[model samples]
Target: MDISLWDQLQSMDKPQTTLNNSVDRVSDEAIERYARSKWLRHKVDDYIKDDKFRRKSVEAFHADLQKLSNNDAKSLLHVSNILDNRSLENIGLDSGDYRNLLITYLQSRQDPLSTYRELILYKIHNVLPEEYLGWFKDDLRCSLFLAYLVKDSIFINAYKGREELISVVTDYLRYEIHMFIEEYTQNLPAYKVDYKGVGEHKTVDILYAKSVYLKNRSKEKDLKWLDSSNQHQIDWTYNYLNEEKRSYIILEDIFFPQTKEEKYELIIASLDILSNVEGTDVESLAILKKRKGDTKIISRGNSERIDVIQRMKKAWVQLGTDTKNSKDKLVLNITNKNKEKLVALAKNVNQTPNKFINQAIEDVHREVFKIDG
Candidate 1:
């Protein structure tokens, strides 16, 4: 519905006399007078109930009303005589201030498209499974984050043109909304609802309105709410994740928990390994967000994995195992005292006993045979 400036000003002339002292609402009289359609009237009603639009618009309208000309004061006085002056006063308006009040009231009505965009994005952030959000938000950055949020190949295939990217995001929004409403609200056999319901303020009508709005508005400013940047750190994150993509599909997978204790154990284990790696500075190269019991590990460094993998290779060689070739373990009976001595020697040289003993035996054998000479 396109309301011209002429229409907006013309509608303001009509009087809105209805009042409810108990709660703030746009009366049916005002709805019928201004909305001009049954569907829009229902949307207007829901819009008032919606905390986002109502609270914001009302607060803004009050502030703007104070700045409007005093010419409306006489009109406010006339309205006070016809309606509950106390209610008008409570809302910070004189009775004849009806024109601006009605205009503001109608303005508070949501554009179903914008409402849908907001709700779908909200659902993505708050209601969808955390795994999906984590995958898109944690790993993917820049416009790539928005691209992955769609979970479709279209944006990538299309070379991510601005309009094409927007279309993909909008398509995803509608798809998710349909799936959520069908699975949670409409499909009674599939989903068992508690007495309180899956969502309280988030009713089917509200969701449906938002979906309709999203479809209508996707081409316009639907994506304006999305941050200009992908809300991720710029430094090292992209390079690191890209480089380690094959080994670590998602960084969060490293911190996944079998139990709470195991989750913490993984964090400690990573820290222990990374901390002990020689010839590399893990702390300077990586950012690990660990505080006591918290299990989250955000690796925003490029060379952290490189350092860790190198250390693991060194450990395997020290254990008498070749990473590239299969090697059978060699066990020999040795006196406890000599074994202890070998362990001490290995510790002093920062080598495993297996590595130290093998090197010592080779050196003695070479000397006895004069192998090099």
Candidate 2:
């Protein structure tokens, strides 16, 4: 909250904020601009360090803003006018940058068309109500910081009223944060996958962008980056949970089927403990573009004529009884006479009957080498 910005809001007499009539609230645009100009990056290091100066700065800010009445929209937007040498960029309000802490703190004005006025009439007038106000004293610079308290609370919405305004502030915050990160660079790797243990017991894990992490020290392991469009993903991270061993992981963003009936079978086949996948709801069958010959599939989820779907199910059943694989492991406890339908159901969508039989083998091949259907 720049004191000058606060001063501009005071003149609007927005809704509530007002100060004691006894206090001298001066709308001296030149003086407020002069104060803002003094706290450039080089000057900021000193003000935040000194207690007396910080207090004096904020109080002076409050006083200067208190000057103008609620008819100062013109002055509020054109802060550049009062100061001859300072530009908006020169008035930095970055996370950990305290130049405009006072102004950003002001948020929406009580009488916004005017200055940094307090609500004299409201039941919650005077000092910032404890519940509504929060303060952060952090050195960890992040985009979240850039948007609101540190930047603009306009980006994140904890509730409905706050939620609606999030995008407006978030866009501005994104540009500012990106510029900040570019300026103060920290090279972080995106989307990593690590494997641990052996065979069926081995697990593949996932992570988003982690600001705080460590590298695997053991020379035996190397990082594999799986990049599509999103680079900010953290694919691998050291897991302290299992012990001293570091782990590699991959992010698999698979949306789950929405209907309970639809989800029960497909989700079971697709997800496993070691498979790094996530999901929320069901996917309606896609309006699939064809591979030209697959014109029948375009009509319905069911395969027609000789019934490709029915044949695939029959194949899976034969294979499950004869072959040993992961999917078969899931059905192990089910009495053979009880879940014949589920077994048949899984078989039906197993990508054709021969494919249904060789499915686990194909998965094995994929793990050994990067192959996709």
Candidate 3:
């Protein structure tokens, strides 16, 4: 069985040694050619040959490596080994070019841990070029870094002068948070079919009630772009968790339905009541024009009229029945203060103002236009 170079590199205790062995097997001419490259020679003399600088750099690198998660540490080691094994002919470039290639590779991979390390190096030691800043700007890694900062701001304390960096990157962080909330909510199960015979109605109802409460709370709060502050991030996280919890509860309710059909019927009936109330409003009559159809009135040129008709249609559909056509039509123009009173009445009944007015009209029609069946 042939193991790939990457697997071997991952398993090896001393990856650098393994890479050096591979280099040794290559022709000395290739090695001498690489050694004589002016860019490589100058880099080695300026940085690698300086004992104090070299020692400090190594120490810093190892210290940072220790701070990474296990998987991240392993990935960084593998990438380092790959760079170390690049031959003069394979790389065919100067030291600065090689460095650029390495940085590009790390950023393209969007390896958060590696990018964070590069950020530390560039911002603190000045070993890397300013162009390497792109690593921190990448969307996914930037969110990861923001998460880290939220967890422990001390990690980047060395670059206190660059607070502007957080401001620049936090938009992506907000976008990520939005996406997470949407994804979590959308994936929740909408109905449950498994608890037909079991006594799960109460459990399901409790869960759904809790979910509805949390979802309503989230709706009440502003969910748009937030300021790039630790407090804002923390608030966003709390809201996100509430959204997630709500979704989970909804999923549970869906997977264990109890009298769901009856519940739906009650909901539809309540909505029908609200719709009837809206239909009787003077505003509704004023906005609707006489039409030759079973629905009686058609919306005039007003967009609000059209919207109301659409909502009425939806409510009728939910009621599982159609309304009778009325040939008679009436138009009324009420005072603005009366309309405000109508709105207040609707709110008190947990219905739209238009809906309450329509229901009142229906009540008056029944009393005035009584016809024996």
Candidate 4:
């Protein structure tokens, strides 16, 4: 007799009989297993009746399957069969494809379209087994799947539209270009040139030039806050300098300005914005303009030749003064090995160790607070 039917018979009112003994002899483990099987079947039936619940059940199963280890082969095979029956190929993935695709996607930086496709495949793979296994409730599973679809669509459309993609790519490239410029400027050779006809011309590194220009052109109130707009302008200036011809001329002028001033002027003229925050040197602009009309005036040994160096020195002093007056100081006890490292880094950037330390503190403060001065 069927175990459930026997169980039912035992529950019915009846006189004591030998059959009762057989019913009572059934193992507790078997009865428990039967009860669990019935409960699971009922849940599955209910899930099938509701379209929304059915979809969620499948999504939950796939999510759980992603987190499973190799030890879960039996469960994995079961889920695979359900997915296969539901025509998994329609979404361009099969039972065994999800894990490998996800792993590849994580490791690769392929084009946006391919990445979006991989993401969609991963989300939609193997939906039926989860439903049968009751892995996630209807609402949560639907929500997670819907959310993934929406996000994936945005990325897909962004790529197709091109404008958004260009903007994102430009921002990323801008950051990389700015970083290279910063390093390049900080480590420029401090070479001096003495032309036979022209008086001695002192070379000003890019960072020093920028700092001096920013200080002299802007008011104290303007310099008090280096906000997002200021930072964007700074980034744009660095990116502009990253152009091959512009960078070459700038470096040549820094080393041999007496001979290369014309080339430098041409590069500087390419810059579109010339406001205070953009750090355009008005004196340099005026000199260049005058030289355009009569080259001999600029070619002659003029006091303006040394003005940039003097401005740079003044900027350094201002930085030190501001750091000293603005805040309380903290003393740190560091190991000699670390001290040696710091000293080496300071030397590389032509900074005193104390000034380097202050610069590092300021950098950290900006990172933590998202504010700058």
Candidate 4 or 2, higher TM-score: 2
Summarize candidate 4's per-residue lDDT along 1-373 as a digit string, tens digits.
4443223333445433332233222223332232223333333344335444322322232343355343122222323434345432322235455554443332333232233223223223321122222221222211122122123222232231223233332322221223333343222222121112221111122223333333333233422332233444334334445556534222222121121322222223222112222122455445444443222222323233133323433654676587888677667898999999999999999999999999998999999999966
What clash count does candidate 3 reach? 12
Cα lDDT tens digits, model 2, 50-137, are: 4433223235555554443321222232232222234454332333333233344344444232232221111112111222111211
Residue 195 of model 4, lDDT score: 18
lDDT of 3 by residue, 120-221 (tens): 332222121223224344432232223232322222322211233343334222222223332322222121111212223222322332243223222112
Winning model by lDDT: 1
Ranking by TM-score: 1, 3, 2, 4
- Where model 2 places Cα greater than 4 Å from the true spot, the runs are 1-281, 284-373
Compared with the true structure, all predictions reach lDDT values of: 0.36, 0.29, 0.34, 0.35
Residue 48, candidate 1: Cα error in Å is 17
Rank by lDDT, descending?
1, 4, 3, 2
**TM-score of predicted model 4?**
0.15
The candidate 1 region of ten consecutive residues with least summed lDDT is 186-195
The top-ranked prediction according to TM-score is: 1
In order of appearance, the predictions have TM-scores of 0.20, 0.17, 0.18, 0.15
| Per-candidate total of colliding backbone pairs | 7, 50, 12, 4
